[model samples]
Target chain A: MRNDGETIELIERLARLVTNEGHAHGLKPAQWEALRYLARANRFSRTPGGLTAYLGLTKGTVSQTLMSLERAGLVEKTANPGDARSVQLGLTEKGRALLPLDGMATIQKAFEALPQPLRATLGDGVAALVTSALAARSGRAFGICHDCRHFAADARGPGQHYCRLLKQPLEDAEAEQICQEQEAA
Target chain B: MRNDGETIELIERLARLVTNEGHAHGLKPAQWEALRYLARANRFSRTPGGLTAYLGLTKGTVSQTLMSLERAGLVEKTANPGDARSVQLGLTEKGRALLPLDGMATIQKAFEALPQPLRATLGDGVAALVTSALAARSGRAFGICHDCRHFAADARGPGQHYCRLLKQPLEDAEAEQICQEQEAA
Candidate 1:
């Protein structure tokens, strides 16, 4: 069996390789991360503050990254309807178009080629590692809505769900998207 | 079975989480990466050019990262005896002492708790993903010396090996370290 040190080493190398791949499309590594987060986050998790928490970066760095993305026409910001003082963020058409063609295509192909059981095992192992690390550091999990403790199922409706904390109905699609307020269920 | 998209998403999330973990220890994400690389890299692979290739970053970015590490007194540079024009990098005592106590301690504990087979499977899957992504992008593998095509085994010695690329004999420990010039055998 491989020792703990080797496992940590492999994880570190994989993380670096994945990040370097994200740098290929005229974006810095951090920019790619922010863009990807915005793409996955639900509407409620689309603010600069959400990004700052999700990326675990300084507010200044996240703001700078957002400004750069806004300048490139890849991301747009609008005043929040509920609170005009705050802003909401979303990817533009160009950003959405670039998502499917990013450097992760190769990684996706590699993952697709793995055996089903191995793929599941890998995912579980990685998820456990992420959960443990974040818990140790008191970092936010930013998990999918369906997995959060606040998720409440609607028994009468086939696909409807609710966020008990937000007091809002969640569509099927939104339930699958990541949320900044997610807590383990 | 999880589909390809889900597999890719898990890996991306894991990568981001792992990278964020490195940001907690008074080092930026990139600085921790560079320092970790220097700690595990062989003597021949400990140069600025090697780091640039291994990290797949521009010369300027790698230089800036190295400068930051130097300023923190975590890394030291000296002229390479084999080639005066190039310099070699090594971690200071302060750096070596910090390596064992980095933010990865929690990650290591998580990895240690995994069943051995699951751990091996996860490592293999990730390595395959990294190798495929790197190959698709024409990036260096930066693999261990023993895995390189240039690795030459000494029939008479029990553990001695040599690197044909560097024309240098490799200690057993050195043969286990990652090399910037590694090409799969």
Candidate 2:
């Protein structure tokens, strides 16, 4: 059996191999992660605090990354209705256009190259480990809004969905996004 | 079954979660990865070129990281007897001592907290994925010297090991370390 230390090292190296990509785009790995999260995160979950938690990074680092994204015209700050002092982030059209060139594409291609059967098993195994890690740290489990306990479907029509926790209506595509406030059903 | 997109995101987030933990230390995630590699690598694998291929990053980034590590007194450069222009890296007293506080330990702990059976499976599965990724990229598969096809047992005595590729004797413990040139037997 492979030792736990060796196992951890394997995980670490895999992480590095994937994360180390995308530097060619002039964006750091952290920035790419932030951009990807911002793209998939719902409007309510697009704040810096939400990103900091989701990325498991310090507020300082997140703040700097956001600043750079803004300077590069890839991200824009919008006023938050809930808090006057806080702002929500959204990707500019330029950001959306550039995502296709993301370094993550390389990893996605690598992942796809795996035998199809192993893909699902590896996914489930990895998701379980993430849950365990969050549980150990008492950290939040960020997940898709559609999967959350608060998600109520058919609020208005067959395709319409609602968030019971936030008491907000979700657009068809938005409901499928990741949310900072997601709670397991 | 979980979709492939979600699976990729899961792997990405888990990587972020574990890698983000060690930022509490002054080192960047890349630096920590480099430090960890240096610690486990055999003397032959301690050069910057070996690290670049192992990391799949550009030589420029690796060079900058090494410079920072040297400035911090964590890594020291030593002359290469075979090639005067090239240098090999060795961890200094400070470098070796600081490893205990590596953010990687946080990941190691999280990996250990996983159910016993799952850990091995996860390790093997991850290893397979990495191998697949490397194959897809035509990248190097850096591994422990002991497992390399070139590894020879009892070349001089029962405890003595030899690296046929380099035609050199390996100390008992060094044979178990990672080698840049390692190949499957």
Candidate 3:
């Protein structure tokens, strides 16, 4: 347990660090996280409720973050065209534009700089921890479209897949986006 | 790069989830982090400025967080006896009592549940990432006392080490706590 305690503390320290990544941009860490999630989410997972689930935060907190992003013109709430009572969230052009400059890139660059073999091992280890944590929390995996059990090879088109759950066609690009409803294949 | 991207995202997602851990206890995740850091910090690392550097956040943000913790009676700020202009932070009895119930326990338990070999690998990976991120930021390592270059194996006492930087003797327990001034031995 002693060694395990050290490991947990290491992870926790890094967790605290990621919260400061958004500081330089004059945005709260949560706001930066929300923007990143919105940009990477699939159409069905771009709602406020989806965000609340993904962040594991209260709806009040999620709503407040969304409101601040809207106030800053980085995110917008739009009425769902298909369901009048529903709402959909989308990043404003500014939001999409700012994604490139996010502190996340700095971290990814650090990853890229690692030796290839170490990077591979590091990826495997991180993926395992993420899996273990999600299982412990009983949370959704929120994985990419192609990784979902509902993805069907329908011959819809080249590099296209169909979502049996949503009954909608998904392109290659969309298949790489994360969805709230994703269940691993 | 694709795998690295996935790994980085996994780490970031876990990071965001960690911020929500303190929600049920009426503490912002950052506040909980501060409490944890203060509790585990060596005497020299338990001040507002030390905390700011440790969290890699602005002093303004750290001061604001400290103010909230003070109002909540979870933390106390006392003027340093050696330096009237400096302040030292300590957790209240209530604060110490609440730590066992902190959301950090859930994640730590998840790490504990892993098989021993996997836990070792996961720890290695996480430690590597933390090191990489800190290097990318050019931040201090903020490691434990025994690992510091200044740890002198003092012959004056058993299981006691002298700190060259602080010019102080450290107990076995204190040598295990994180210190702001620690540099690799």
Candidate 4:
């Protein structure tokens, strides 16, 4: 059996590799993570609180990161319809443009080069590790809408989905995006 | 075939998981990474420049990180014997003790629960990904001493290893640790 220490080291190396890749696009590691999160998160999951939970960072840090992104014209805050007290986040055209240059292309190509079965296994293994780590800290999983416990298929209409927790219908695109309220079914 | 975007998302989640885990130990994500690096790096790989290369961060950020770590008493710096102008780093006893509580134990346990073959495959896959990412960024791999191109087994006394690049005999412990000068053979 591979020793636990060796296994941990490999996982740590993988994490560092991703962090190092973030430095290529004039963004800090945290900023890259936030940008990616905003791009993939559902509308309901795009608030400051949602980001703070998803990133597991202090409120101040998340706020500061958002301010930096906003100042760079990469992200904008819009009024939240569900709650006017808070705002929703969205990436600007410039931010969407920058996503292609965020250095994920190289990683994507590298991942695709792996044997197909191994790639699947690696993804499963990593997902399990993320779940385990988050569970250890009582952190939210921020899973995609389709996998959430509250997800209801075709509850509203054909090609539409529903969130039992949010009591709202979800567009097809939102069903595929991650949500802060996601819980494993 | 799994899409490239899905593969990249999995990799990003894995990285964020590690970053979130760092919050539990009262250390920022960068500080945890620095501590882990010092603990696993070989004697020659423990310099600030080595860390900068490994992390792909600015020299200023690395310097600040080292300063924070030194202030926390988790790391100590000593003059490098090979280079008088540079310094070497090592983990303090307290730092070594803190590692067990740095939230890796949960991950180690979770990893051990995986099937042994899967664990091996996962490690190999992650190592390959890390190698690819570092190569893309022109960053140092900081690989294990035994895997380095310059490593010569049993080149010194009986059962002794050597690093041709550093012209240094390697203790068994150092052979297993990562080195700054390491390049794939």
Candidate 5:
């Protein structure tokens, strides 16, 4: 078991790393989070309220982040059809381009720095653990359809179904719905 | 190297987990980071500028977070003698009391949720990768102090007074000062 101090330290450090990454792209931490959320959204129907809920931030905070995102040409705001006071947030093409594709490069560099034995010992499960922990810490759930490689409809299964990512089963309902982890091209 | 999409998905998941912990503690992620930072600080000082630089937050943002922490009774502010605009941030008794003494219990619970083999591997530094990655991303360096680890003050022979934490001979300056890593506590 790790100490609370240790866990807190790790979390704080992780936050700072993400903050730096955001800064590299000229965005604040909250703004980066808001952009990341938008980039991962599949259908582009995210309500400001939904973003606030997902981020565990206040409406004001979400509004502020969205404003910054808009200024950076990373997000688009549209009036909500169902409600007059609310608005829907969507990602721009620029936002899609900025969604951390180089993150893997960064991770690879970090991985290479580790001792060889440690890298060899880490399996898919360890990667899964990181996902799960990140999910748990971010107020979201991991192991969604997006994370599953088998989630492709073209794969062999009923209705062109099989999750290659998880190499497991993909539920019928999951195939039709968009996951928060899904990123639109 | 892992796919960038996959890594981002995993990180988002981890962020969610940390966010949940933040919510459980009745604080926002930023607020939690502030508390954890204060708890880990061995010595305290004043200046919104310093805290902003340390946390990588904007002045406005740091001021807001400090306001919230102060209102929650988790932190106290004092007049800085030299700088009138700047103030010293200190942990209140309530804040100190809020620090969990035995967070290993929580970590143990998280470990129990995982498989046994995985638990054993964490000790070998797989778990520490998250910290290392964060530090790298933030461009921060950290090393423990020699005095805290009991390095001999009077060692005539070169390389004799080694720090157990650093596992190396400490320079004269390093003996008295702690690095960013230890500051994470």
Candidate 6:
């Protein structure tokens, strides 16, 4: 409901990106999706809970991805001794083994193929943007620009502040919108 | 492995982008991940094969996403008339109903949030980029530049040509690499 067209497009582009990389890396898109979540996850089983919140999907979907990954030995699921209702998710040796950790040659080849300037331009900028976006999702309010933070007042003029990382300003309205990240930053 | 620290960083960043959006949309990351894939799908059903190729997700992983979406009534599965062995994936009315078609509002809001120059600099450029990216992926090519009709060898330079749409020069090596997209494109 809160998602606008631009947000949707951004989401789709991101998804395509993930799909492309995951497939190229020989991992399922879901596996990649799950893996990505796991990479950011604090606890293993909590991964599913995060997936449920971020995707607007059902518990069953999360369960299925976890199940398959577990079966393939890409991830391991263990009973949560602390929480009887939850299970922990973590990467298996095989899963980690299959993942070139750094990603396989194709990914490197892709990077190598790019011109140095292009690589520099896209590489750092994209990485920084991703990090900022990811961090924003954590529940804690990011304390960079007061007005720019989502909690800041937006009734004022232009209602936007420049982001050092993005090297651009976001609308005041956008700042007010909650970031979807799971943990508190 | 060929993945440079930068490339992994970029990919991880993209993942964060996904997580951020998922959190904002009140969708769990995994559910949102599935939704993102479904939106990019050609057909409503968006066969597991298509997902496999497009998202780089494994069969099992895609299957799980599909199964979950199906359970949620966001997507439905129908037998592939052409290939009895396969099933065509299609979005449910519910799914289609949730999607933001062009994302104009979000873009407009985002654009308005920026400085006049930044808006001007990125406005048309971003739109064109998205269009080119989408057009290039019309289920014909795998979103590769070379395979795109716009991709042409520069008559003046051995590896130089202009992407008719992006209006950028395309080098020969870059063009060749993009050819991989043609297989899926």
Best by DockQ: 2
Alpha-carbon DockQ of candidate 3: 0.61
Question: Per-residue lDDT for B9-80 in model 2, tens only?
Answer: 988888777777657578887788788889999998899999998988889989999999999999999999
Please report, as a residue range, the 10-residue window in candidate 6 chain A with the lowest summed lDDT. Answer: A139-148
Chain A TM-score of model 1 comes to: 0.92
True contacts kept of 6: 0.13
- Please report the candidate that would top TM-score against the real structure: 3
User: Candidate 3 — which residues are off by over 4 angstroms?
Assistant: none
Q: Kindly list the per-residue Cα lDDT of model 1 for residues B144-183, writing each as its tens digit.
A: 7888899998733878777788788888899889888888
Kindly report which residue pairs in candidate 3 clash with one another: none
lDDT of each: 0.80, 0.85, 0.84, 0.81, 0.56, 0.51
Write model 4 residue lDDT over B2-33, tens digit each, in one string. 35576678778777777667765688878888
Candidate 2's C-alpha runs over 4 A off are none
Residue A22 displacement in candidate 6 (angstroms): 8.2
DockQ of candidate 4, scored on C-alphas against the true complex (2 decimals): 0.55
Sorted on DockQ, highest at the top, how do the candidates line up?
Answer: 2, 3, 1, 4, 5, 6
Residue pairs in steric clash, candidate 4? none
Candidate 5 residues A125-144, lDDT tens each? Answer: 34545534534444343234
Candidate 3 lDDT at B77 equals 91
Query: Which numbered prediction scores highest in lDDT against the true structure?
Result: 2
- Candidate 4 docking classification: medium
Per-candidate DockQ versus the true complex?
Answer: 0.56, 0.63, 0.61, 0.55, 0.24, 0.12
Worst 10 residues of 2 chain B by lDDT: B16-25
**Higher DockQ: candidate 2 or 5?**
2
Q: In candidate 6 chain B, what residue range of length 10 has the lowest lDDT sum?
A: B176-185
lDDT of 5 at B99: 65
